[model samples]
Target: MNTRPLLEVEDLRVSFPGTTGEVEAVRGIGFSLGREKLGLVGESGSGKTMTGRAILGLVPPPGRVTARRLAFEGRDILGLDAAGLRRLRGARIAMVLQDPKYALNPVMTVGRQIAEAHRAHGRASGREAERKALELLSAVRLRDPERVARAYPHQLSGGMGQRVMIAMMLAPEPALLIADEPTSALDVTVRTQVLAILDELVTARGMGLLFISHDLNLVASFCDRVMVMYAGRILETCRADALSQAQHPYTRGLLASLPRLDRPAETLPVLARDPRWLDDARADA
Candidate 1:
């Protein structure tokens, strides 16, 4: 087994040029991902998705992304040009965006979409691509894979849409999968099903997973490790089992804010904000 990390990011920074000045969205965050599930938990504006986008070189114009080290499968992605990044995006590292409604093409059949993704990285005939697409759909637990493949995105529910997205992402058999809130838009039942599909796929394929979301409890239960971010910086990083025992106040507050069925608090406590949590501790250390 290749024991080295599939994805490594160190001292990553993303800044946007605003009228007032520069606004740093990702202020020097570092973490590594192997062939295991890693969760990034934080509130909005914490740079979770931005960090994933930066990994794929998806940051929009006027936003600058810089990193001391950014590598995937031992290849340095930091300096990769557009063509190189495109090859790496779906072939080496695939991403599942938050909503499939926006991610999928309305006019294209689900099978065509997945087939296109497969063909993007390698050569495949139409029949071969369709066969692979149906197999991918089946892998994600989609019922009646052939029918689902022929259906359009609008014909499917949110959960099914997400499943199609997952199938497409998995079609190329990428080494790393970055899922940014892949289930956030679905209902509780659908969300669990979608997450389970993702978990099973990652485990079965031994692919590295970067699950980005603001739900701390989900992260705690689902991921091997959890990274808590605040104001574009990591507040704490610890094993999933140790999340409740996290040392940082910010992480503790986040865990406390979640509604727990076992504890059954009358009212969940509000998270207290602290500017000091965003300070660069690496410099002081």
Candidate 2:
């Protein structure tokens, strides 16, 4: 069995033009991901989403992505040309975006979309692609696969749309799955169901998952390890179960800001920011 990491990043930076000058969205961040669930948690504008997009070659033009080393399963991501990146994406690596409505085609039926995804990467015959599309819908625990498959994107509920997106991403059986806030739009119960399906699929397939979200507690419970980001850099990383014990001031403050049911406070505590935390984020990590 191959023991190498599925993804490796070092000195990764993403920048864009600002009014004054170039503004770095993702500071120099580095980490390796194996075949396990790893959570990237941070507040809005912390560069969590930019980092994921950079890895998948989805960063829009005018955004500069640079790294000393950015590799996926031994291939240099930064060095890959457009065609190479396109071939790599959806086949070797798949991303489940935050909103399925926008990610999926509006005019196509769900079955055709999934079948297209499968056929695009897997090179399956028309009949085989359709069959696998239904199977994948069932795998995501979507009831009445046949009926759901025939429906359009707008016909499905939030949870059902998310499940279809997951099924679409899984069509190629990619080695790495980048799930960027896939559950953020769902209600609590539906979120739990989607997470359960993600867990089952990732575990069964031995796929590396880069789960990005702003929910620290949710990430702590769902992932094996966690990385806390702030101001475009990772401030701390630790076992997900031990995130409460994190020593970084930023991590601690973020945790304290959450309103816990057991702690019944009238108001949640506000997170206090320190300039030094940004300066020392790399060292802390």
> Which candidate should be chosen as best, given lDDT against the real structure?
2
Off by over 4 Å in 2: 283-285
Instruction: List lDDT for all candidates, in order.
Output: 0.88, 0.92
Clashes of 1: 0
Write candidate 1's Cα lDDT for 108-188 as tens digits.
Answer: 999999999999888999889989999999988888999999999999999899999999988898889999998888998
lDDT of 2 by residue, 92-204 (tens): 89999889989888899999999999999976999999999999999989989999999999999989999999999999999999999999999999999999988986788
Which consecutive 10 residues in model 2 have the weakest lDDT in total? 276-285
